[model samples]
Target chain A: NAGLTDVREAVAGSLSAESGVKLSADHVVMVCGAAGGLNITLKALLDPDEEVIVFSPFFVEYLFYSDNHGGKTVIVPTHEDFSLNFNELRKALSPKTKAVIINSPNNPTGVVYSRAMLTELAEVLRQHTSDTGNPVYLISDDPYKKIVFDGVETPNIMELYENSIYITSHSKDLALPGERIGYVAVHPKCADAESLMSGLIFCNRVLGFVNAPALIQRAVKNVQDVSVDAEMYRKKRDFLYGELTRIGYSVVKPQGAFYLFPKSPIKDEVAFVQKLAEKKVLVVPGRGFGSPGYFRISYCVPDKVLEGSIHGFENAFSEAMK
Target chain B: NAGLTDVREAVAGSLSAESGVKLSADHVVMVCGAAGGLNITLKALLDPDEEVIVFSPFFVEYLFYSDNHGGKTVIVPTHEDFSLNFNELRKALSPKTKAVIINSPNNPTGVVYSRAMLTELAEVLRQHTSDTGNPVYLISDDPYKKIVFDGVETPNIMELYENSIYITSHSKDLALPGERIGYVAVHPKCADAESLMSGLIFCNRVLGFVNAPALIQRAVKNVQDVSVDAEMYRKKRDFLYGELTRIGYSVVKPQGAFYLFPKSPIKDEVAFVQKLAEKKVLVVPGRGFGSPGYFRISYCVPDKVLEGSIHGFENAFSEAMK
Candidate 1:
């Protein structure tokens, strides 16, 4: 139930090498995917009506996953640049707070939280724990950890906090989302880490996942260090970023992942998305991610498709501005 | 997500051929396994505090699976020969009863329900559904459907009842438990079948499964008719059954699967199990399956191991009788 030992050992070695923290196979539990990892982690940590905190412009499914285990979601807004807003997070921390989920290189927004930022966040959580006499768990969802552009490194949450759980998947890195394979790494120094691991293993079965798919577990063990070339995504990102910005659409440069979240020319992003769809260009409304007045464009398509959408993007932006 | 279209079509065709019912891809929902199928089905059918009926000497996980979806389990005892007891089932039905789960060729007992028996059970459920104005779903868990012995055929529940859901996994028949792949087939004639299927698909994602693993789904699509050799399991069953009964253990002649549930020599089956363990023979106490005074022996091991355990079985039986 914890997982196949050799697969867990390989993941432990890989995470340890990247995080500079000593980890063992005993701390790792294989899961269906990042979705599966989050579900099991929440199930292990939550009692009824306990709260979980998430930054605004978050993965929409985070709300559903928390609710699945009877945990309420508390949304805290990030800064304009999608950086951690510590004031908001500090206010969001209450005795009912069981966990805080951080995703970087984030989904929808593509902003990667820096090490200095994480250290400050950890300090705030530590102070809250001491003040309230309740432990706050940091859950880092890192499916895009290997898809970062430039030389930016995703700092491991385990090294940043004592009571943290690190989860990741092969979906974005290996481009195997349909395969549904991932793992959860519990910090060795986590509060009640042993019991948490046992609970995760127990929930994995009772929740009907049983274990991660066996064929993928065997297939991915040897390829732990391999990932799809980020340059391809980088090229696609550059093309869409350049085209959308040149077309007079206000956009922030994405550091990682394959998304570009740009402010909508109009206040209602959903209306703008419908206009773009009429022009044969598709993008998700930011309201879907809990932030309105903005929209998300996924740049993981072929070059021809991205190039072809340029005309539609230009027409939609010009019409919206007019 | 519903799943890959081609895979669903393949499964639909295979089920149609086997059950002689006209099924389409729209009626099928791919799942992680039989466990995944059951969870989604129960989640879709159950409201809070509703009841799901199961037979005694059942798979232990049925209780947890039912409770996972806010449903309570009401166990109906089977007859002395491990057949369906209609009187207990009739007495157990209530306005709160939302579903009835049947597993055949059953676990622990390996008792396969004949087509005539299933017809009678369906009639009883239909009468109950009419008596109380609430629909009762029949969920057939058929992981061991293809493992029947002595040329006995297992009836498909979809053909037997209008409000039936048929779930099967490649885990047992294809001998691929670790692969974690299966599908749920909702009878097209089921009450509100379209809405039920939509709920199942929604629950499949929200429950953290998302979909069945991609590799196995693709692989099994072409081999739906293939299964492990039931004769091999039959040989092992024969060896264990012949030897145990010859040594004065009262055992049932199994018609399917690979289990033998025998009356324990002593009234306390747990103590009998411990004695057997001391003699290097291991069998599960019947209390684990909601039945007592009998123990279960699984004969799916290699022939050499079955042969080697005979002496232990003999010694344990003699000591218990003395």
Candidate 2:
């Protein structure tokens, strides 16, 4: 009853094909979600005061996950374009650095890191490990793996970094956020991959997950191929992104996922979000993601809701400008 | 996505009525199962090296649960009848004593602790708390609460102690072990009950459970009032107990749960279990639960299997006696 056998292998097969990252059944650890997978992986890898480097304005939960397992999270601010600032990332690395967690088709900004960026990061990690003898793992979370727009390619990070872990769920892909089902794929070439897999399974139990939900595991296998209407989300993103940029709100074009981050019209994102709330617009302050002076708008809602919120966004922006 | 609103409140109400404990919605925290609830509660309440006292021949997972959260599990041997020895328990308690985890309709022995024993233990705890100024939480895991035979009453430890935390799963009662749905109910009268409830919910998320399975949570509410087939199990228990005792085996008449524990005619219970396995009769050695010279037989299978296995149990017991 720990986990259904076919579903675990099914998840492995599904991920190997979807990710282009070769994996065996032993490599796939089914989890509650990307959140579940990430936390389990972190618990397995981290000791007290161990450093996990995460980019700022990252999914805020990453910090919570690390801290929950006694790992210290080191946050590096991203560039204005929301690309990996490798120079800053390199400066953040040290002997204490245990892993770097990256979310592609990222949550708030929807900025997908290309293969080139990943390969460069891998190279940086390899050099540092060679110099300091402290290996740093690359943990890639891709809940929005299938939600890319404009034909963006999300690199199989495992292919670039031998010490990579691919964590994801079908929450975004299958429109099943409430299900909380996902997996952790340990890279075959990762250092001590077998040991890492064992630790992950042990942590999965001791950390109280015991295993991923049984029914959802079975359900996932049956509907692994069922695709959500990503185009609908794409349409929503395009409309919302256009509206923000059209009114002189500086916002990056989202490459994937269903969220767009725009610079607040005022310096105080909290105050600006409050101003928007007054217009019945609900945007999260960037401070929630450790990046203030910006606001996040999620388009993963009803079309009518998105349509109705347009006026709120415009009104809030105009009022902030005044 | 976090939890079903009604499920937590429903669990609180259900347990309150069943156990005669006073609990509100805030007192109940839904979890994946007793395993999930236990681990989260341990993580919240235990600091490194704190002691959680468990009676020997207890549920084996209790040790693992304590160790998972850096707590030391101190095992106290049970009385010959598998009852709690208050004297031994009193000796086990110290300034470092944090919790006492007990399972009634016990896992291996199936000895349901009476209300009197629970009250005595509660008084011991109250005196210890008064003298040492440290609260000792009584953690009662009641997965088999509804499985008791012969009309035995499973004491609600919350009614016995203010600091009690009841951890349970509906797997046994609802026959839904595969679903992994359960909850933790913080005692309303407990000191820091509010903080404990908050810690439990936080631990549920950060420990990678996120929440109990959403579908199971909903399903539990619908079938919460469904009756368990206690008679079917009682019939199996009676037959199994009769056959073993008739064959000159020393077996206790199990008052609850689906298991029967019989003293091995041989001092080596592990070897006795192995002998039974040789005849294709599966039984677990009590050594696994910290009580050697005994083995646990589960009557959870069909009656046909139980009938067919009678020869194996008799043959093994006779051989061990020789």
Candidate 3:
């Protein structure tokens, strides 16, 4: 019942149709949250020592979730500019590689993986599966699917990869992180689709989200089309990015999601976060995201909170420089 | 967040007041569900190989929950009528016993423990604690707390036992089973109360509920005073009990909850369930509830479902006799 509820199926189905693909309810596995979705999918695909290739500076929970299910993480670090690192990715791929996890409108870096990049990634996975004599699933951690600006089309990985699974939630899109509702939809064309569905259901039960909260499953179904105000996030992103850069901090300009990953003026990102705490600006260290020398500022806070912190950031930056 | 949302605490607090216990925010540990609450309490209190005692004909999940946390269940069979067998209980206690699980308006049986029985049981727990080195925790599973019949009082175990942790949920009471919302509350007087709170919170997060579903937490908070109609359950129980008894079945009349456990006319309860199922009347075997020669009929269905099944039950009973 968790995220694979009837309503979630409807949402995923509608979304799939909009992308010009046919999807069925059998493909949907409701989950507790995006974490739940990830855990469930990993549980479905992983055997002991099976490896999942992750693009680093990834959402760190992926490591924990994968380990929880006995899978080893094969980290493929992105480039200096935080773009797709195909060279590193190709090196990471192996016969034991069971999956590759992609977070488009990525967390930490907030770089949306371009269509060409996604297509290439899918091609790699398809080729690797054929070459290795086993399937390597493509998992899209896509909580920020609808949060991108400029009306760019996000690549449907399920469309391009025959062995793709989509994991998403209303946590970011509908701004319901605490609701603990989301879904895992396997591409119907995925190899051994029925086994995947069974594994997902077992994972959902054993991982302890008996089902998603029922009413929210229905409530989210009603609001699947309703989206968060991306303009608000864009403004916050602009303000934070400009302010941090003006203060001589290096950072990737986030393309989607509500976070700015700015390089720390100090060598230790954790210490930098501690110093920001001293300035009463709470931010998470990039070390937690597997990328030191950077820290992330969540832009999801109300404008007033961010506006009030502008002075704090400026003063902290000046003091740190001193 | 699984069930850690403040709103879920508020709802749990409001509902705890139904038993005359005024719960503050600190009292509620929002959970994955009641199962999560029970498992959390066990994890908090039990060390590896610690023992938990339970009366037989208990909920099956108790076995898995206790074992999951390295607690062994010491089973003490109840009286022939499924009431507490005090004599058997007195012999079951050991130094390794960390807790005793009690369910009322009991599952699979629907027998509400009388106030005198609960008082006497509390005394037994107290005496056991005194005889042993540490106080034994009383774990009360009271999902059917609000469902009672003929204006009977279901003694609040928390009121009777100071060292009790009460695990209850809105699933049964509010008919919101899919919501996966519930709470675990430690009595203020429990030993090492603060540590217990920490353990519960730790368990909550470690179990991956992270917190309860947020909207249901808020929804329950809003409708804490509302309850499903117990009168309907009472009527169904009465009708089902009467029909079975009239057909020469020996049954203990259920005083609360939405189930009726009746002695089978045949020795094998499994066969009885199969016979009933043949008549298109589904019922669980008593063996599943830690007893044989008796079967449980969940009367949660509407009156029409019950009334329509009367002739069916009659026919099944007659055929079994033949």
- For every model shown, the clashing-pair count is 0, 2, 16
Clash pairs for candidate 2: A32-A180, B32-B180
TM-score of each: 0.98, 0.94, 0.87
- For each candidate, what is the lDDT? 0.91, 0.85, 0.81
Whole-model alpha-carbon lDDT for candidate 3: 0.81
Candidate 1 lDDT (Cα, 0 to 1) = 0.91
Q: Please provide, for model 3 over B1-322, each residue's C-alpha lDDT reduced to its tens digit, 9 standing for 90 to 100.
A: 2254567466546646755666567767877678768876887788878999988898877886776566799999999778899999889888888999999989988988999999999999899888886889988898898888898998777778888888888889888877788778777778887889888887666545667776666667777677799988887887788888999888899788888888888999898889888889998998887888888888888778889888878998899899
- lDDT by residue for model 2 over A1-322, one digit each (tens)? 2257788777767767866787778888888787778888998999889999999788888888888777899999889899989899989998999999999989888888988888888999999999999889999898888888777788778778888998888888988866768888888889999999999998877766778877788888877667687788889988888877887899989889989999998999999999889999888999999899988988888989988998888888787777
lDDT of 1 by residue, A108-160 (tens): 99988889999998999999999988899999999999998888877898888
Model 1: number of backbone collisions: 0
Residue B180's C-alpha lDDT in candidate 2? 74
lDDT of 3 by residue, A152-269 (tens): 6787787788888888888898887777888888888898888888988866665556687776777777776788988878888888888778878888887888878888887887
Best TM-score among the predictions, by candidate number: 1
What's the true lDDT of residue B126 in model 2?
A: 95
**What CAPRI grade goes to candidate 3?**
acceptable
Q: How many backbone clashes does candidate 3 have?
A: 16
Candidate 1 error regions (>4 Å):
none
**Where is model 3 more than 4 Å wrong at Cα?**
A2-9, A18-21, A42-55, A63-76, A84-100, A123-135, A202-208, B1-23, B39-55, B63-76, B85-100, B119-136, B202-207, B222-226
Which candidate's lDDT is highest?
Answer: 1
State the iRMSD of every prediction, in order shown. 1.1, 1.9, 2.7
**Clash number for candidate 2:** 2
Candidate 1, residues B15-62: lDDT per residue as tens digits?
Answer: 898878899999999999998899989988988899999998998999
